[model samples]
Target: MTAGAAISRRALLAAGAAVGIGGTLMPARTGLARVPAAFEPTQRLTLSAGETELRLLGPDRPATRIYAYDGDQFRLVRVPRGTRLEARFENGLSEASTVHFHGIRMPNEYDGVPTLTQPVVQPGGSFTYRIPFDDPGTFFFHPHCDETGQAGRGLVGVLLVEDPRDPAFDTEHVLCLKDWRLDDRGGFLPMSEPDGAAKAGTFGATRTVNGRVHLDLTAPAGGDVRLRILNVDSTRVMDIGVEGAEAWLIAIDGHALPPVPMDTLPDGIWRMGPAQRIDVQVRMPMEGGPVTIGDYRASDVFTFATIAAAGRVRRPRRGGPLALPPPKLPLPDLKAAEFHSFTLQQATDAAVKDTGLPPEDPLAKALIDSLCVGGATYWSIAQQSWPTGEARHLPPPLARMEAGKSYRIEIKNETRYPHPVHLHGHAFAVLGSSKGRLPKHFADTVLTQPGEAVEIAFVAAPGDWVFHCHILEHMETGMMGWFRVV
Candidate 1:
C-alpha cells in the first residue's frame, strides 16, 4: 500500500473473515536477518516503492512526486487473527528497504530490519516474510531503512487482524491520520533537518486523513460503530476526540482494555503519540446528525471525518460499550524478576551526568558521536548512542539473561520530548510509571512521557532483541539499543 492509500476489514459483514484493502488509518530501523530466504511464499505480491505525482495542494499547483506502496499511497492487508501470513515482497525502489510490521509480535526473523532481523530487500530483488498472527488488533507496516524518507514519501500500510468474537457494530471506520511536508508548488522538501531530527522529529506542513482532505463518512442513526484510528505521521502527536456523540474507549495499542470513562482523560480527548492505536465505540444520535471526529491538539483544530447519519434511523445495538476478551499473554512475575534501568537523554545535554559505560569499553565514547546522521547525533539510551551506517554499533547487552527468566526494566526519559519506545520480539506488561501506578496491560510498544519513568516486566526470550524509540529518525540517528537473551 502507498502512503495516501487505505485498507478496511468491515466487520466481515457477518463474521471473522476480513475483506480487502479499502479503508482505515495507521512506524522502525536496522539489524541483520537471522534467517536465509529459501522457499517460495504461500502468498506473493509485488510492492513497488517510487515517486507518484499527487495534486495535494491544488489543481493549479504543480503535482508533487511522492512515494507509494504498490502505486497506492497506502496498501491495506486484512486477514483473520490467526492467519499465517506468508507474503513475498519484491523491492522495486532505487534504494534498500524492508517491511516492518509495526506492533505485531512475530518471529524475529520475519520482523523486517536491514542486517538486524533480515537483510534489506534490495531494488529489483525480493524477500519473503512468514508469520502467524497471535493477537488481533490495529497494526501498521512501513520501511525500516531510510524510514524518514521512505515513509515520508508514502510507503505505509494498514494490517488488520479480526477476532470472531469481537463486538458487532453497524459499521466500522479506519482513520489513518498523517501530515506531509510540501513546497509551494506541492513539490518535495528535505525530509529531515539536523535540528528537527535531534529534537522533536520533523513535523509535516499539511494534515491528511487516509490520504485525502475532507473525508466524510456515513452511519445509521443510533447505530453502533467502531473507529480504529492510527497516527502514521512521522512526528505530529494527536489529541483526538468526538464532537457530536459520546464515545467509549475500547482498546489501546491493540490490547483489549476495559472501557474507561471518557472523563478519565483531559477534555475526554485521547493523546496518541507516533505508532499508537486507539479503538473507540460511538453511537450516532437517534436523530440524523454529523458526529465529527476531530484532532484538537494543534493550534488550528480541524475535523478529519464526519460520521453523518445519512441512512434510516436504526435501533441501538447494545446498551453499553462492547466488551472484548482479554488476551492470554505471558505475564511476568514481578517479585522474582531481576531489575535494570536505562535513562533516555539527548547527546548534547549537559544537565545529566553519563553512567552506563565503563572506561574499558571497546566502542569509545567519542566514536559514538561519529555515527550521527544529518551532521549531529541527537539522542541516547543509557548514555550510549546506537550509531548508524559504518558506525552502526550494537553495543554490549543492556541486560543478559537466560531464556524464560522474568525481568523488569525501568525506562526513564529525562528529555523534554516524548518517544514511543518499541521492543522487537516480546510483549511486556506495563508494570508501573513514575507518574503513578498504571493499569497493567501487554504491549510491544509503549509511550514514555517526558520527565517520567516507566517500568515494564517480561519473561526473557532467547534471541538478540533490539529496543529503541519508534520515531524513525530518532532510531536511525541514536535512540536505539538491544539486549541478548541466550
Candidate 2:
C-alpha cells in the first residue's frame, strides 16, 4: 500500500484501539455520554472520518488517516441560505477531540472549541452540534483541543454553506492549505521545545496544497474558474501567487472584497493566519497554458501544484462573486473599545519539567516531560486554562454589548512567534494595528509577529463566544479562553 494509505490505516487502527484503552486507562475521559451539560446540545449524532474496518470503541477499525493541516478540496453543495444544520460527531481520537467550523457564524453551542465552548468528545461517545447557516462561503472545521497533535494528524474537513444570492460560477472549488512536519515514513513529529514554547511551534518541512502532496487541476480548454483557498496551518504564514494564468480576488475569509485583479501575484504564498479564506478567479488560457498556484520562495523546496488547461472550455464574463449583504450587525468602534494589552510569554523548561509530579501518568510531571519535544507550553488567556470559567472573573469590556452590540478588540503579541487569533460567533473588520496604534491591512486573524499588535472591530452576535490563538499546538496546551453573552 502507498505511504498515505498506510498512514490512514494506522490512524484508524490507533483510534479504534484507543477507545477500548480509554475505558480502562482514562476511565473518567471515556464515553462522551457523560460530557458536561454545557457541552451537550439538545441533540447528538454518530460520525467518523473514514469508512473502513474501524470501531470507535473496539479493536477492529477502518483506515482513517489525519493529514497535517493543508489545503483540502471540497464541493459547495447548494443549501438554503438560512438553514440550520444539526450534526452529531464522534471525535475519532483516543483522549479528547472537537471540531470548529471557522468563519461560519453559528450558534455559540455549535462553535466547536473544546473546554471553552464544550468538552472534547470522549473516544467512543457522541455529541450533537446545532449551527444556523445564516451566512455562506468558504469555511473550515478542525479539532480545537490538543490542536498540536490532533490537527497535525489530519482531523479537518470543509463546510461550504452556499448563499442564495451567490451567482453561479463555471466552477467552484474549496482549497485548504496546510503543511506537515514528518519523517521519511510520513508520521508527524511532535512540536515540543525544551526552552521556549514559540520555538516548539513553527513551520514544518513539507507543504501540501490540498491535504495531499501535489495538485493537478483540469480546467475547460477555455473557461473562468473560481478557487476558494483557506490557510489552515498551525504556524506557517504562506505567501501565495499564480503563474501562467490570469486571476482576480473575489473574497477574503468569507467576506466579499471589492474585485482586485491578480497581476503581480501575492508574493506566491497565501499569507493569512489560520481560519482565513480568500477567493480568486482564474481564467483558462486560450492556448492551454500551465497555471501554477503556490509559492516560489528561496526557502520553498517545491511547487505545490499546476493546473493544466488542455480541454474544451467556455468563456464567461468576469465579475466578482454575487454581492453578499453586509453582516446583520455593524462594525465595532475602536475608540470606545475597552483597550486591553495581552502578552505571549514562554514558560521555562525547568519550571515545566519537574512539577514534583509522578512518572507513569500521562498527565504526570515526568510523563508530560517526556512528551516535551521542545519543552514548549502553549500560553493561557489571562493565566487560566481552557474550558474553564475564568473569563467571568475578568472585567467585561466597557461597551456592555447587547445581543447585537458592536465592539472593538486590540490584540498585542509580546513574543516573536506569529499567532492566528480567531473569534467565535461574528465576522469582524480588521480596523488596523501597530506597536501602539497604526493602521495595518484589514484581516480576520492578523499573523502578528513578536512585539507586533493589531486591532479588530466586530459586531458581537449573541451566544457563548471564544477568542484564542490559532496555533493549533499552543491552543492545545493552554492558549485558549472564552466570552459569553446572555
Candidate 3:
C-alpha cells in the first residue's frame, strides 16, 4: 500500500475494503515503493552508467535517475540553464523502468506514458521528476516504459538542452545513434515483448556510435566541429554519410536548416528512422588521421564513426560562428480541417498472446491462427486493452475545434509496421502523400510505412491532443489515439 499519487480502481478498493485485503475487492498496489530522495534546484547533475533505472510515468511515487548504457554510451548531467528540474529517479535495472523526455515540452503531466503519464516503474522502483528546461535544442532521453524492452536494454541518453541561442562551438559533438541485439557471444540483449504481438518491436543487429565499438572523434588541428546526431532506435532505418569531411548541413528533425553546404549525400547514406535528429558542420583535416562518418548498409565498408584529423590548428571562423534561429513554424490551416484516419491493424500470435507483452512470430503465428479460427471477435479501436495510454475518441462534442480553429489530419498505415507519426500541441505539414507527390516537405512526424498514407495540416491549437505511434511498444500495445481542441 505504499507508492502514492495516482488513485482510483474504486479508490483502491475503498482503501482495501476498509482494511482486510479480502475477496470482492482488490487493486491496492501503487508503484510498490522507493523514490523519495528529492532534489530539484537544478545544478546537481550526475548520471553515472553501467546499470540504470528511473520510473515515473504513472502512479508516481519516487523514481528517477536513468543511467544504463551497454553499447554506444549514456550520460546526461545537464542542469544549468534556467534549471527547475526536480530529480530523484534511480532504477539500476533488473527490470521494470520508465523515464522519457525525448524533446521535452513537459506537462501532459510529464508525458512519460506508461498507463499514460504515470504508474509502472516496478523493479527497483523510484520516480520523481519535475523537469523544465525551457526549450533549448538537440534533446533526448529514453525508456518510455518497456519501450521495446527498455530501449533495447541500453536505455538511452543524450539531451543537450542549452540553447542560449547556442553559437559558440569549436567542438560541440554529441552523437547518440543506436541498435543492439547480440547473442552468439556478444552480450547486452535482454529486451522482451518477443512477438506475442505489438507486431513489430525488437530490432538490433549491433550498431553503435556513442557507446562506441567504433565512433571516434578528435578535431583540434584544423578545428571546427559540431555534429549532434541522434537516432535512439526501436526499429531501424539508417543510411548516414560523410567521408572526407567538409560537411555543413545545420539541422533537421531538431529544426534549424539553412546552411546546406554539407554535400556528398547523394543518398549514399544518412537516411534515418526511429526518432531522428541531425545537425552537422565539419571542416577538420590537417594530418590528424581518420575521417569516415557512416556506413554498414550490409557492407559498404563498415565504419560507424571516425573523425580524428587534428595536428595543430584553429582556422575556424569560416561561417560566422552563429545562425541557427529560423525554425518555429507552428502551422495550422487548410480551411479548418479536422479530418482523421489511422488504421494500423494486425495482431495475432493469439493476438500477441492476449496483449501481455511478448509472443508471436511465424508470420505472427500464422496470422493468429487465421483470426481466431472460429472464436472471432476482433473489432478494435477503442475497446481499450493494451495500454489505454488515453484518448480513445472525442470530437463529436459539437464537432470540437474552436480555440483558434485550424486542423487537418489524415494518417493511414493499415499494418506492416512503420509509424513514426506523432503530434501533440503543434507542428505539421507534409500535405502530400496519399503515397504520391511528396517533395516539398516539412514534417513534425510522418513515416507511415506499410500501406502508407499521410496528410497533415495543422493549426488547431487548443490542447489535449496526442495521436501516437512513435513505436514505444506501439504506444504500449494498442497503438494509441487521441484528440481535442476547445
* Model 1: per-residue Cα lDDT at residue 41: 40
- Runs in model 3 deviating more than 4 A are 1-176, 185-191, 194-207, 210-212, 217-220, 226-228, 235-252, 257-306, 310-315, 318-320, 331-421, 424-458, 461-466, 469-471, 474-476, 482-486
lDDT string for model 2 (1-486, tens) is 001212233345546645553321121221012223443333333345322221111134222234322222221233455665666665444444566667777656556644334544555655666666666666777655445555555556766666667656566556677776665554455543323233535566667766566778767755777788877666666666777877776666766655556663334344566667777878767784588877544475456667776566545455443334443435566666544445455434332221221344222221111111112244655444332112212212112245655566767776567777777767777766574332232344556666777777776666556676776656544454445554
Residue-wise C-alpha lDDT for candidate 3, range 319-374, written one tens digit per residue: 43345766556556676566765455654434422332123311111121110011
> Per-candidate TM vs. native?
0.84, 0.72, 0.31
Once model 3 is optimally superposed onto the true structure by TM-score, how far is the C-alpha of residue 244 displaced, in angstroms? 21
Whole-model Cα lDDT per candidate?
0.70, 0.53, 0.52
Q: Model 3 Cα displacement at 26 (Å)? A: 51
Q: Compare the candidates by TM-score and give the number of the best one.
A: 1
Per-model clash counts, in order, read: 24, 38, 40
Q: lDDT rank, highest first?
A: 1, 2, 3
Ranking by TM-score: 1, 2, 3
Q: List runs of model 2 lying over 4 Å from the truth.
A: 1-46, 49-78, 191-196, 200-202, 264-270, 296-298, 316-330, 333-402, 435-444
